[model samples]
Target: MLFDAGTWSLITDVLAAVFILAGAFLTFAAGIGALRFPSLLARMHAVTKPQVLGLILLLIGLSLRVRSWSAVAMLALVVAFQLLTAPVGAHLVSRAGFRTGKVDESELQPNQMEPDDDEHTA
Candidate 1:
């Protein structure tokens, strides 16, 4: 009743195209940042943040284009797995770098990872 079927279809197609292009741009930027950033933490940040968002956006566009519940469900699962793993993987890598002395303590603010000196006194 609101919009004709043809107009609605056109609108969805336009939106899908916009989402896909934006997602692709963000994914490309993430790759560039991962390669260009000077520090491990910076690279991890680049890989995790924009990469996840780009994947989510790309999947949304795909779901819109496919218009199938099974495909959307599978895409949602992929997004869920990505969201769940990226941070955990980043944390593990950063922790390993910190423990192995690959990470510079000077770059860390506050440096809470260091054991407090007072704990041994008690």
Candidate 2:
């Protein structure tokens, strides 16, 4: 009950194609959302979330196709840097937007980041 080498190779190829297509689609969608979204936070969400996932998917597909440990190590480093940086970058952008009043206060739910009048007076 085992696939032959050729069959296994074909299966991996198909799966790799699927992942690559999905990753491409998500990356495309992220671009569209970044352009179309009206708000800074929305654009940030679009850019950070889908792009990171898309990148991971793309790297996974590449690894599957390349089937080389060295290539995978490089891809892993890419993903690691992406994972580490994307969130921090998003947070910084969002905070900058909020502080600069680019984000409308009314749209924020909870709005914990809003500065209190007392703090301003002090």
On the 0 to 100 scale, the lDDT of residue 18 in model 2 is 91
Candidates' C-alpha lDDT: 0.91, 0.94
Candidate 1 local accuracy as lDDT? 0.91
Best by lDDT: 2
TM-scores for the candidates: 0.88, 0.87
lDDT of 2 at 22: 93
Off by over 4 Å in 2: 111-122
Candidate 1 Cα misplacement greater than 4 A, ranges? 111-122
Candidate 2: TM-score? 0.87
Task: Tell me the lDDT of model 2 at 88.
Answer: 100
Could you report the Cα RMSD, in angstroms, for every candidate shown?
2.6, 3.9
